[model samples]
Target: MSKRKGEISREKILSSAEYLFAANGYHGTTVSQIVREAGLTQAAFYLYFKSKEEILDEIFLNFERQLDQFVETGQQLNQHNFSEVEKHLTQTYIGLFQLFGANKNVIKIVFNEGGQGEKLRRRIVNQIHTNMTQNQSLGILKPEINTEVFAELLVASIERIAIRYGIDEDYSPAYLGHSLAGILFQGVLTKNT
Candidate 1:
């Protein structure tokens, strides 16, 4: 096959797998089903991916690379001012949700059915913990709070909110980000002061 044809077939296979994985769950999806969905033969599917897991991995690898860039950008931020911190965090949340929103089906597959989801979840939590620790050290964040626990809560809350609101609907990402930042900074209860 020509290189162009090969690339087209590869993309078709990936798109088919993504749809099926999202609909049927990963273990329930098979190579034959993917090939049938893609309107390609088993031979053509094999030409692109050695196995279903490879295609899943490829999808997640792209997400992982993007997420890494997000985390790295957050880490490079050195804003000590409270307003700047809130702005950076709001941008971070918006960007993170936008990443998932852009790839909703892939996010569903990985988070619901793939082992890599758990790994990615843990990595994100750890990254949050590390970033919070650094912020406290730099005096950008309060040193009194236990950052490890807070990191876990933050990661879990973001995932829950994204899955609930950001994935399928036209809800505002900016509102979600700003609301989360408010809760993070001020807690749920109104401050008397």
Candidate 2:
């Protein structure tokens, strides 16, 4: 009973913190504000986490959990040609915003509302690195540049595309992801059938 209660309180704190940080960014949102908004005492807040940074790391990690899950699942998905990887990644990127709707809170926290260091970013990047490994093994990804750099660019492109389609409405993340993936694989020039 006590353990369940503690877990509930921690989740409450996390939920409140995710919303606050998502709306305000890491630096802008303070522990006091979180505690106040959560209706939990600072002592209770400290009981769950040592500091705000710890909370940020936890939320950042959790945020990636959903997106990461989709990517990881894609790798295992049985595709004969294996270009399905790109399709899966595009759906995942577009899904990120569509999953949260027009809220933009999650995007704001993860990208625009910045103050996050390389730590959280790299953890997410590490997933891409794993994909890079698979792509190289299968000869899908090129080895010209370092995998890290390429993965970084891939992540950035997806981020930009998501934001563009998410806010602008002129573009669609899903469609754009597929189009970009096709371009990457087939090149800019049209081929004669």
Report each candidate's C-alpha RMSD, comma-separated, in the order given: 2.3, 4.4
Error at 44, model 1, angstroms? 0.6
lDDT of each: 0.84, 0.69
Compared with the true structure, the alpha-carbon lDDT of candidate 2 equals 0.69
* Clashing residue pairs, backbone N/CA/C < 3 A, model 2: none
- Can you give the TM-score per candidate against the true fold? 0.92, 0.67
For candidate 1, the per-residue lDDT at 121 reads 82
How much is the lDDT of residue 63 in candidate 1? 82
lDDT by residue (tens digit), candidate 1, 1-193: 4579889899999999999999999999999999999999999998878899999999888888888876665475574365677788788888888887888888888679646899888888788789878877887777898988987898888888888998976577877888888888767875664
Error (Å) of candidate 1 at residue 37 is 1.3
Give the alpha carbon lDDT tens digit for every residue of 52-128 in model 2: 88887776666667666655643653453665666665566567546434545666677754455355567667777
Model 1's alpha-carbon lDDT is 0.84
